[model samples]
Target: SQQGEEDPQALSIQEGENATMNCSYKTSINNLQWYRQNSGRGLVHLILIRSNEREKHSGRLRVTLDTSKKSSSLLITASRAADTASYFCATVVNTIQGAQKLVFGQGTRLTINP
Candidate 1:
């Protein structure tokens, strides 16, 4: 499958702690993005890293991409209870049809306790 795999199916941490998530893909990709989904809701884009970028940071979030290793990682610092959500990694694949689509990983469920 073209979809990527995210490590640590679940995590539980106290507020103010940090959460780190990793992803690995099998095929070449144009870009990789991370999203967060609250329970019973849709996903919200968090960050996007191009194949040419090695690392990026936004607010309390950090994302790293290693195309050579077909892997990526996301780090959230000083997480709050409100940060509880399912985090996903999505790979952008260019198809022969001249279109692109996102193949998402199963995701990592994060729970932050107050």
Candidate 2:
């Protein structure tokens, strides 16, 4: 399956703490994208790192890619209740249709304890 596997199906953290999530994939992909969904809302693209990129950072988010291990990690520093959401790592797979599609994993539901 193209869907990547994200661990820590659920996470609970206090404000000002850090949250870390991991994702592992089985196949070769063009890129991996991290998206956040807030309580029944549509997903917001957090970041996307191509297979050739080793690491990327955006605001409080830090992402590291290890192609050798076929895995990636996302770290959220200085977390808050507003950061509570479901994070999904979607893999962009190249298909015969000449279109790259994103396959979402089950996701990790992160809750910030106030």
- Separately for all candidates shown, the number of backbone clashes (residues 3 or more apart, or on different chains) is 0, 0
lDDT of each: 0.94, 0.92
lDDT for predicted candidate 2 compared with the true structure: 0.92
Reference-based TM-score of each model: 0.95, 0.95
Name every residue pair that clashes in candidate 1: none
* TM-score of candidate 2 to 2 decimals: 0.95
In model 2, what lDDT does residue 95 have?
76
Best by lDDT: 1
Worst 10 residues of 1 by lDDT: 1-10
Residue 36 shift from truth in candidate 2, angstroms: 0.3
